[model samples]
Target chain A: MQVTMCPERAIMEHVTSRWAVLVLQLLSNGEAWRFSELRRELEIVSEKMLTQTLRTLERDGFVHREVRPVIPPHVEYTLTPLGKGAANHLVALAQWIKANHPEVAQAQQHYDAS
Target chain B: MQVTMCPERAIMEHVTSRWAVLVLQLLSNGEAWRFSELRRELEIVSEKMLTQTLRTLERDGFVHREVRPVIPPHVEYTLTPLGKGAANHLVALAQWIKANHPEVAQAQQHYDAS
Candidate 1:
């Protein structure tokens, strides 16, 4: 399971990247978000990075971007059904880290002290 | 859930890095692996990157590196309990990606044709 030439690794990397993980989780929060909304929500991510991440996710078929013609134009990003499957697992991993931070911190202290 | 300055983000980043994910999946396959064995198994990962990934995982309490007092220095890497939790979720993510690649590919084709 180690060696991989599968394009899926690229998909995995795109989904699990720091910005991508946040993007997936944010979109999966049962709402569609415009570019500005996502930018505002993910406060720490640069606009360029967020756009790049979204493009990668879109290309991977995990994110659907909608564009509407308006006076100023309307655009929104949401997770595809397939993306929901990917997000479910990524969220589990993210929650696990959040829930177990104390144990990880304790281990860090122990390793440091030794 | 977007803006995060939490140290846990760093931990999550370390665990989800490309090499780290592969290493965790390999370890969670219920086997201990020496450095060389891992290098050989993960043929695409460079030695320095693999060592760095293992060190990060070790420092995060997700991996244990056992070094025996022997002539050639027998060292092995395995998942700690905490690491197992992290790996379980990652493996689920990996498996989902692997299982759903066909769906993803179909989506990709649809996107490409448009």
Candidate 2:
């Protein structure tokens, strides 16, 4: 990554963003995700935030947005090839966290008590 | 990870955050980092944000901040053992990005043209 180009950082952040990680993880199953489906999966995410996150991912090319022209205009999101790679790293990170949660919890308790 | 507790999400967000990832990655070398050294390393980070980031990580037990009394107080930050685990995952994510930058860049360019 060039130190001069913030664009790289910006793009990195897009995929690794708080909500983006979860979204990418969901889409990593190689399935097209409806906006509703994504919302249902990440229940804590607000509609506005989900919309923004999807748009940002779409703009960055990590997510492919498909809108079918019909009465309701079916909309779906899926990982682009690039997104799949990013999702792989994120899932690994999440798994790492889960495996190490007990140690981290102990550290947190130690810190809190100090 | 439980969906009910936002603290898990919040703590996860803290370590995975843009600045935190970089900071943790740097600290993974098992070297204590001074405030000035970290600032110089991450040139783009504002002092305010760095301070906040460090404090948060320290509170969360991911970082240990030490202040030594002297004519000029010596302050240093080091990653705890638990932090080492988090940093490992973050560095993996970063490495994955560098290795796959070409594909991602292509995707970005393709998206822009569309």
Candidate 3:
């Protein structure tokens, strides 16, 4: 199909963004994660970037964010049904990369050598 | 899983890169496409960007580039077996996005209204 700038492509870019993909994968376990927990899991992610990523996912309906009113607000993020569906595909892709990355690396080495 | 900068992540990035995803989707039909044909299909992609994207995919062993010696050098691109596997996952993700994007848009509208 001939391509143009479109919303679908934009959403795809969001879903497949580096942090978004990791967030989906982390949430795919069906457990809600506190923002700090998620941050800890993705240790290298900056606070600003993680917050932005979660907001994007939540806005896209792939994540549900709940804030409990307490002395310190307890915030949790979980995948919505739509998000789970997306995560399944992404996790499968991640698994495939994990399993077959050696071959890809080998190919890169060969290509670089030649 | 905590992700640091790693080969698997790098390969995943290449596979999911904007042009890579489009290229794989286009090649999923299993027909060999000439450079001009692909460039035409992805109308907005620059010739240089297309060349670079093809090289990256080619290096990853996801794309097979065959140059036929003729009056003019005829180069054709097709997905390798490995690439076909990756494309299936990406195409599924694309299909899911196509079907559910309306809901996502609605969610975005709802979120924005608040």
Q: Which candidate tops TM-score?
A: 1
Docking class of 2: acceptable
> How do the residues A56-90 of candidate 2 rate in per-residue lDDT, one tens digit apiece?
88876788998888887899898988788788877
Off by over 4 Å in 1: A2-5, B2-5
Best by DockQ: 1
Interface RMSD of 1: 2.1
* Pairwise lDDT winner, candidates 1 and 3: 3
TM-score result, candidate 1:
0.93
Span of 10 residues, lowest total lDDT, candidate 3 chain B: B1-10
lDDT of 1 by residue, B40-76 (tens): 8877788899989998888888899999789978999
Cα displacement (Å) at residue A4, model 1: 5.8
Off by over 4 Å in 3: A2-5, B2-5
Query: Model 2, stretches more than 4 Å misplaced?
Result: A1-5, A68-71, B1-5, B68-71
Candidate 2 chain B has its poorest 10 consecutive residues by lDDT at B1-10
* Clashing pairs for predicted structure model 2, backbone only: none
Q: Per-prediction TM-score, please?
A: 0.93, 0.86, 0.92
What is the descending lDDT order?
A: 3, 1, 2
